[model samples]
Target: MILKLISRSKQLVPHSPVRILSLYAVLALLLFSAVLLVGLMPADAHAARILEPKQISGAFPTLAASFNPHEQVGHDQMENMDHGHDSGLSVSTALFYTARIVYYTALLMAAGMMLWFSGIRSGSDEQRKRMQQWSLPMMRALLLASLLYVFANARSLMEGYGGGGPEWLRLFTETNTGQAWLALLILSLLGFAVIKASDTFKLIWALLLLAIESWSGHVAALQSNMNLGIVLDFIHLACAAVWSGGLMILLGLWFVDRKEAGRFAERFTTAAWISMALLIITGAAITLLLLPSLSYLFYTSWGIWLIVKIALVALVIVTGALLRARVRRGELPDGLMLKVDAGLMLVITLIVGVFTYMSPLPDNTPVRFHKMGETRHFTVNITPNEPGTNQFEVKIWLPEQLGEPSEVKLVLHSRDRQQLAPLEVPLAIFEDKSYESFPGFVRTSYHAEQMDIPFPGKWTAELQVVDKSGEKVEESIDFENY
Candidate 1:
């Protein structure tokens, strides 16, 4: 069976160097595809314990500073509780990295395909023969390297999926490994030999690694349906590789084959336009799905970075158009045109790099509460329901005369509020009133001026409340102390 396959491969139609170049072209595409797959499949879980309170607050100080407009001050301060925005930000960041790889890889691959097809269509038989001769070795080397790179990165890709490990490590350890390094080395050497020998069958064999690596990411059964994300990620990645790989080829041809520059540029222009359209359409779709809310887009650092990246993309498009027009008018020399195009390509690469760290917006909006105002007093009324577990009734009395409490919290005493800890109070809320359970103590939910204090020693409770300005306010219990 293998012998038959080898015979068939060697007999591929037109058996020219152009056909052989397809092998390298495909390999380049697969490499970027793998990158996209790894990148878009969701980043490995990194949310372990947040750093110190200061660090948590500092990581996004800009967003933090703007919290007043978007959040409740004094209540639900940024110092506590992991915000859902973090998750959204993470999603966006991961996709940004993936998108970057996709864009560049797609550009290179698309350029290559464009140049190859165009050259073949217009060049003479001798020119075609020269291309074939040169392409054989070059394609072989690229194919070999691509195979190794893919396999080498496989383990890191697999690690993204939950595997057996220490509980903490499972959530935080990010692996960038591919597969067994030694195995990759051996395969790379062997593939190199096969390509050098023009063993066409081995090319297909090399492609198998890419297929396997991509498939491994789709084996999940969780609420996130990570499997679906993995699949979409792969599709997105494959498209990117084709686009980038082709671009690389086109660029190389435009520079090296100056005599045939016109044909090469024309071919690349068409491919670039098509690739750009696909890039914009797919990117928009992904953005819409990932960034559902405009608020998330504006309130997070990820959103801001994304805006920056999109602006760069706009510049790239404009520059690309200018270069194409110059080439058509024959106003600019091939050398200068190539340099300008290359510069534009670099700008595109830079945009992708910036995208690597931003996060995506969330699909749903989280519930938010208002902060206590000057008229309001931070209050917590706990009523005993059982011997051990108490129904916790927590509320910030909005002074009917003034407005709302200065702050609201859940704690034994107001003094305990600054302790920056969650109060393990058995608590429940009933409408406007709160209920709590205290051992050997009892109290009603609504008692004239907030009843339901059992234990002495100035017990306090801490609660997060938002101010009118939407800034989080950290109000504590005053109790016997301040």
Candidate 2:
């Protein structure tokens, strides 16, 4: 069966595989069209994704209000965005994800072709010819995508974190997200220089490119077990690139010559098989890193996108198996199935580009409580304000009148449920500048903190302050756990 493709390459075919690839090209465009439509959904509409998406993936999409899972586009914010402004935001977002999608496709395709051709032990001429024809364009796409991602990402970040920023150039150099963007831009430039380099050089280039992807991803953002997360993300990305990139190059080769392409396809199917195995394995490892809990899969937008990606991947695998079976039986494959397989891979890439940019930590909205008593001010702030174990910080203002309080306690109580027992955590000295006492102020600031929340519900936190005179001034505010 493999011999058929090898022999067929030597013989002339009646038609160009260009039309078939043109079919793939149309499918690719349609895939992008779908991504753009979803990306440009109304601001509030985007906020409700779960039944939604995770991107803006790989770059600037996180800065786009439409795609940032951590910073939701609230109704009030959306209401403020009149149709014109809304349209502009949507367009900005659309460009961000679109460029990223194109970038991923091109980078993987270029790298995959390098590996594909390398499989031909003796076809030095064939390899060199294909590299000359294809490598530069793919690298150019990477260069172009990186530039757009930088511009859009900088713009989005400035809008979010700026008066327009700490400034855009500084933003890239000083921040984690920005540094990663810079790496992408720099690496892509380097990619162009190495297009015609040796197979070993190409392999290194591909690994480096995949590494850039890992840097911006949720796996890299893990507060704990970061090394494991990065490994999982890299392996998963490599497998995906191999599978998708190899298929794309193969289709292009089929357009050139079926028999010659067959030699590569025989090797590629083996690569695809290995890649699929690692894809599943690394995907599971990544899930453990990204998913907060099993229940999140059923309810969160991130979980839903993951579920869809899983289903799409399953479809791709089944289709490929059927097509490979046909090849094994000494029969020709219907080119349409291959196109479908390619199309599905593209869609999976789209899904990944978004969610991979999503926050690994599940929803943790900010929660704060502030109130003034006769002689002191009390406050509590919860970061990522979500259920389960939570960080609690309490601040007290000790006027010259109150002096320093003898003790401060962060006491928590349930207002709506009985199962939740009351919790009291003494905020020990917070020596960090943000929590430290600022000198020369009329009112001294005292900050204390603990991390021990066990659940989420309607609750009340009471700030208890004891004066040196043995009197207690207690202030309480009703707030809910996130």
CA lDDT, every model vs. true structure: 0.41, 0.61
Clashes per model (N, Cα, C within 3 A): 84, 9
| Candidate No. with top lDDT | 2
lDDT of 1 by residue, 1-482 (tens): 01112235544233344644464366446545644543464321111111222343455343222312113212243343343223444754455455445433332332233234332343244434544455455545544444434432332233333334442232222221222233334444454444334424343433433333333331211113233333444444344444444445555655566555555455456445555654564454344334323345665555676677577667657766876787678643356545655565555555554443234522222112333454444445333321112334444554243334343334454232345343444434344433533333222221222333321223444566554455565655433210
Residue 333 shift from truth in candidate 2, angstroms: 3.9
Backbone clash total for model 2 is: 9
Model 2 misplaced regions, further than 4 Å: 1-89, 124-128, 160-166, 330-332, 360-362, 365-384, 387-451, 454-482
TM-scores of the candidates are: 0.44, 0.62
